[model samples]
Target: MLGTIIITIFILGPVGVLSQSAENNSISERIIGGHSAAEGQFPYQVSIRVNGKHECGGSIISSFWILTAAHCVARYPLGVLLVVVGTNHVKLGTPYGVAQVFVHEQYESQTKINDIGLIKLAGRINFNAKIKPIQLSTSLQPPGTSCVLSGWGFTNVQTQTIPDSLQYIGMRIVSVERCRAAISAAGLNMPVVDTQVCAFNAPGRGACNADSGGPLVCNGVQYGIVSWGNPCATGVPDVFTSVAANRKWIAIKSGV
Candidate 1:
């Protein structure tokens, strides 16, 4: 029997609550092997916050809809989660309350498949230089296609501290054959399915803790949602919710 594999769904860190206590300085920053991004470089990027701190990353699909990983908000109530958009800096973004949260009905925590989610903003976000909506990719990119990932995740996995500014990293999509081989080589027999998009983080490049729910954009079209991956950027292929395969779900949830 293929033994059970405890796939770690990166929730960024311990579940953050909607509290007013002093900020915890130990949460691992979300992105690894990325540089600082300009204020409006990724206009569709949004920070999913809890109690005024960046908890996970999300993408603005429309004025009122944001797409993210289901595991990011599956446990929280609809109204407690907040969406911060219109800025790159985490603390400087415009905060909007979430009116509803739609986690994919088929989401599986054990395998981390169907890990997509959507958030409806209480009010429409005003489009500006620092805020806009991105188009979801309807087709899959070939292996080795370059894509951009943006987030305020941890700068280094060992240190577990997030940066003061937003971060961006360029990554290449990994072939399913190679991805499965890599996982097997790591002593894991986990299957990499069509619904999951695998991308290379190299040895020092990729999304880390708290980056879940962020977008993987290829050629300016949102391609994937940061789902789960091996700890930090350890050259392991990171798994994402394949946006191309879930286009219908996104369209139904966001009407985009």
Candidate 2:
């Protein structure tokens, strides 16, 4: 049925990857209606950069491991990717080299299912009040749970102007059925599988481009990874790869 729809649904990561329909629309980027994060408020948040540009967000899962969306690192080589941590401002953080990247073998770009990935840092991170690993959630929070999303993605989609500092917003977990209905309402025939969860608030308030791979933390536990969604908020639920669904794979891959 999605194939029957004329309008395209965009991925929320690196640009140039087209939707299943092969449309020319670019990837979604940023967080809408978010507040500027304070120093050390989100210590686990990291800016994932490619070729010296901020392209996605990630979370520190361990001293040596980072969790993000698979689409964020699938196409890029290890050398070009860098992780910046321990600061609210993207440019002010300390940079770390990436030793390796592990994308979920089952990741499907078209559907964005199993869209999780892990990055091993070249060196062990020194944890402090400003830098620490977030605990991966072992279970999904119930629907209507409160959550927070943080990133350094663009605040304005039209101008594509990314903020220099981190931004965050509060959101509520959406039921899978509600999420599916919302997507269907948007005219997309894509599936919102059990391995994924959804979050949303009001219109013009949700994850956007470049916010991909960021953590969707519920009650301080890292529960989801920003994967894809309706571009620029628009009231549709923002879908995320469920962390609990892939916890075993993550443990096997990163031992985190």
lDDT of each model, Cα atoms only? 0.73, 0.78
**Model 1 Cα lDDT, one tens digit per residue, 1-256:** 0001113433221111112121222112256778899779999998888766677889999899999988788887765688988887878888899998999999987667798999999999999888989988889999989888888877766566777788988878877777766655544434578998877656656677768889889999988888766555655677788999999998988788
> Residue 73 deviation, candidate 2, in Å?
0.2
Residue-level lDDT tens digits of model 2 in 203-239: 7666777788899899889988988866666667778
After superposition, the stretches of candidate 1 with alpha carbons farther than 4 Å from their true spots are: 1-29
Q: How many backbone clashes are present in model 2?
A: 6
- Structure candidate 2, residue pairs in collision: 28-209, 29-208, 29-209, 29-210, 30-208, 30-209
**Which candidate leads in lDDT?**
2
Name the candidate that leads on TM-score. 2
**CA RMSD (A), model 2:** 5.9
Clashing residue pair totals per candidate (backbone < 3 A):
6, 6
Alpha carbon deviation, residue 124, candidate 2 (Å): 0.9
For residue 81, what is the lDDT in candidate 2? 94
